[model samples]
Target: MAKLTDMEELASKIIDKNVQSYMREALTCYMTGAYRATIVLSYIALFDDILAKLDVLAKVNKKAKKIYDEVSKKRGNQEVFESDLINQLSSNNLLTSLDSTFLDILRQLRNKAAHPSGHKPSAEEARFIYFESINRFLSKEILSTTQLADEILASTVNKNLFPSTDITTIAKVVRKELENIHPDTYPYLISKLIEKVPSSDGIVSKNTSFFITGLTFDNNDERIVSVVRRMLIEKKSQDEDYFTMIIRSITSNPIVLETVDDVTFKRLKVIIQERISEVDSTLEHSRFSHPVSMFSSMCGVLNDEVISNNFETEFSSAIEKFLYSSYLLNNLSKSEYAKEKYIEILMSKAGSSDFEVANKFARTCYTIIDELDVILTDQNAFKLIVNLLRAASWNAFGAKDLRNAKFQSMPAIRDKARALDLNDKSEAKKIYKEVFGTDTDYENLMGKYVR
Candidate 1:
């Protein structure tokens, strides 16, 4: 909206070399006091920029192709060609009505300036035409190619195109293609991709997710964040799978969390809590893994203080409940990668200074300490033993019975502990004696001590 002060400034905004040439000539004409010539040349530059954009869009868009074909046929007749192009652009939703109106005014000025008329545009009119032309059309990258979104959707099903299972690489390809699209087109593209989520098969669904997540890379545009937030709110209750996909996409790029409003964020917290609570160990691995992954990813986002603290307590409570849930403990023995991953997750929390969470985690581990080989080995096993003793020492009142039950149930746990190197073995024996008020019987460590 700022007024154009210098011709060089106006020319610098233009990207196309052809448009720059026209603007450069217009600047020269304006400097020589040729106001009418400036207005005419600037209009030419604006029209050429529009045509070039339409030509690019025509390759993939029927609307733009039709407009380009119609305008191409009318090229010889300047009056009809310009009028048809502007009216078509406006009607097709490419150019808003206001932009069309501004272009019309510039066209009128150009007509008057080009003709043998007494009317002469002043310097103000010339500069206005120059500035509006660049600001409205030339400098803007308005592809409006919604068809590109369709093509991308189709490409998602093609294995050759998305040959890599790596979501990052696939997302990079998606992001590269999306860079040519106007920001206004993103909402439509995003909605289309989300619409595909609930119904698509695994590969298609995953690729679609990668496509949506790809949009957040290197993009902090509020327009995109607003659209995604609105879609999330709309889809939260309407469709569970759709809601999950959108939320995962947002959390996939945690930076987006920085701009999310508190109300929306609270809703996300509730959804995540519900999902984690819904995790059923009785079901498939994905059922357990999906919610836990969501929980961990959302926790990662909370590291940034920009997110509201109002929901932190609620989220922490959810994390505690999830960490200590009977379902998670049951899942630890399931011979799947999710179990090991969740164990690592538990160990991470247990190793922290949070006594309550660590205690709950340690207590839950009591249910499955005999199944340690299913979840932990080597360093992880040693860490679990160390944490168990640490937690028991912190709350030794009733832990004595529970610890006795665990070691009694799984005497092999002592042999596993004794298998550690001299240093770790010495540390374990030290913590064990401090917690149980007895020395580890190195001669018969696996023997059940009923004290």
Candidate 2:
């Protein structure tokens, strides 16, 4: 048996003053050899502490008070037993499963001492009750939801305080609390979880981030989904599996995806694509929104093999549309480096046996010259026009008059082309004559610009 003074010391630590006093009485009884009286007092003190916990829970859970009221109303003239209080708290979910089981054990011991069972507990059993009730239940205060949330935050805020096992325990606790649909504090808990994303250690932050995916919120109630979006944007994930986990979580959940607004979804899409693109630099460019620049970069940066596979596998039918996309083509024509890719794409199509696509590529290149200083200085641009002009079978200018836009822009093209510091001026001059030929258009061009 524990010493009498040791039992007194345990009683002194009880957080509730009333519970402490009752437990102190129980210790005094045990030290004086009143073992049955000691057991009764210990159970009374434990019961008082449980009542105090129920009172606190009542403030947040209206149902908590109802459970106690029902039990109290039924137990008229009878002292409320530990088993009754335990059942009410357990049924109402005011206590955890483990806690319910522990309380049941304490309740059975209390029954033996309260009702004169033929077998009375020895002084050792009475001492065990006194120590456990004072230290485990009464002395240790049960934290409110807000206090528990604060503890979780403190654990994750830095390395010195963060205990990995503690964090795991907190995660399960928070998840369970949320699962219980504790509306009064759920939003605050979610906010604390998300607030860790940018600042916490990556492993802890990622594990906390998983809380959103594990939750089930309403379609209209986007609080959890919004936090997830913020985590994806703000958290710099180092682990590929972590990144993949988050991406799959968001995309796979229909409710979450639907709840995310367009702007946020677009931003998330950009972040996800950027992460995926880390494997292939070519995939980093915008595929749909800025096709011209994307394709141009792909042409210049990625080798033929990568370009071929990506275009075949990823781009699919988009390849044809991207090649012929006017918005992208216009954007391409304005870029110095992109114009070369533009010319290459057009040349490739222009050389195809498909006459219609070939002719369209030629005419589009001619029309792109209307954009002042757009692509005219590029040798690839010059070569494309030369190849098109020399291929009479394509009949690129069949319906267009010499007085059309292409002819009208000849003087400007000539000036830009002539001023270019080409590595081979002779090749440049030959390219210049093939398209801006020495025909009547050139004599008229020389007359107009010779001054």
Candidate 3:
């Protein structure tokens, strides 16, 4: 055991030193394959060195009794380390599929890197793994530390999507917004936004990314960068119309707002409606120059051949505008449905063929369903989802034939629809069974209203 302990300690130090050397020599002005190979080998050496020492501790290598006494049994607390990482991630309480994938990949590699003789990864392979792992680990931390971007996104009610932007302002927004997320979604959403804004390219683009909103730092430190990023968001929010309203009740979010009551979210509805009124006033403004950015751009006539009944034009007029506008989305959609769509195009576009690289779309749908259910009970939202499912169903077939993607089966669309159905059905069953004895086909009753 003592021999093992000594081995691990020495190995950790060597790994740490080698990593620094590798980074400094391999990257930037010193970029070369030798440096890169050295970096990669350093990572492999970390694991290899540790395992080699442990092997000595084994009966095979001969564990010395006195040496074992000198070594302590407790290494760094694995639970504590993992918990801290998880806590930082969930601090803002939003996780998109991309964020989830980034975490999944990082943790998996970490395990591979830590285990004994874990398949003798090559130097180049080690570098590749390290390359990817570094981003996975740091992306959220970098963004959250930036903090300006989250402020901008959450403050979407007043500002244009790409308002005359700057890195300082972006960092400011991210810092401020982190306090608003419930910590659970923080890591996932933070990862998603940062990954989109390639930090590897340079500091300039990285700084710019924090401004785009939906981004944040992944740590608890309230450093100067964090504070400044927060300051920028608060300042920007203050400049916009209805700033006072959003500022007044930001702590009212259902997903863990500190020092606020649950009822505050209900009051937020009124604030949201007021913001909707504010957006109505901006329609004639000159800034909405992009053709697709217009509030009505994403909206379409719902050719619901099955509905047979016309959607109330009276209601549709107000609702239709709400569906497409980014400003109205956070409020009107009730769930993250609209917000997710906006992110989709922000990251990728139709005919662009750059599918979301980091997140599984289906998993994203599931998460939205889970989070939205906490606050929303609208039947209309469910119907809209059903319509979306239909679209996915049709597109799946076309995609299968055209691109030969394996996920083109009807099952994919059905899975999406079924996620909604299961939630709706379960909710219905509980309510109905509680009210009346037994249940008589719950999905049927719920679908009548939601479908």
lDDT of 1 by residue, 1-451 (tens): 3344555776787878778888888888988889998898887778778888989888767888999988987775554688778888888777767788998898888889999888979988988888778766777776454566667777777556665645467667876777667776788877887777665577777777667666664456778766766665444534567666755665555555655666666666676666656756454322312554433444434442432254444445444555544434444443333444456566555444566565555456556565555446544554555455545556643334445565454455544554653447566556445534665543243343221
- After aligning candidate 1 to the native by TM-score, how far in Å is the CA of 369 from where it should be? 14
Each prediction's RMSD to truth: 8.4, 17.4, 23.9
Candidate achieving the largest lDDT: 1
Candidate 3 stretches with Cα past 4 Å from truth are: 1-22, 25-80, 87-91, 94-96, 134-141, 144-451
The Cα error of candidate 2 at residue 388, in Å, is: 58
lDDT of 3 by residue, 1-451 (tens): 1222332332333323544343434233113434334334443433333223332333221222222222222223322233233333334322334544555554455555455644443444445444433333221222122233344333433434334444245445555554434343444444444333333444433333433332322222333223323333222333333232232222111111222233443443343344445554445321222211222222221122211122123123334333233333333233243334443332232122323311233323342343333323333233333333323334533322322332233333334434556766665354445433455644553354333
- Rank by TM-score, highest first: 1, 2, 3
On a 0 to 100 scale, what is the lDDT of residue 304 in model 2? 49
Which digits, one per residue and each the tens of the lDDT, describe model 2 over residues 235-314?
42433434544443443233443334445544444444544444343432233213333444334333444434333333
- Model 2, global lDDT: 0.52
- Backbone clash numbers for all candidates listed: 0, 0, 39
Q: Which one wins on TM-score?
A: 1
Worst 10 residues of 3 by lDDT: 249-258
Listed in order, each prediction's TM-score against the native is 0.64, 0.36, 0.22
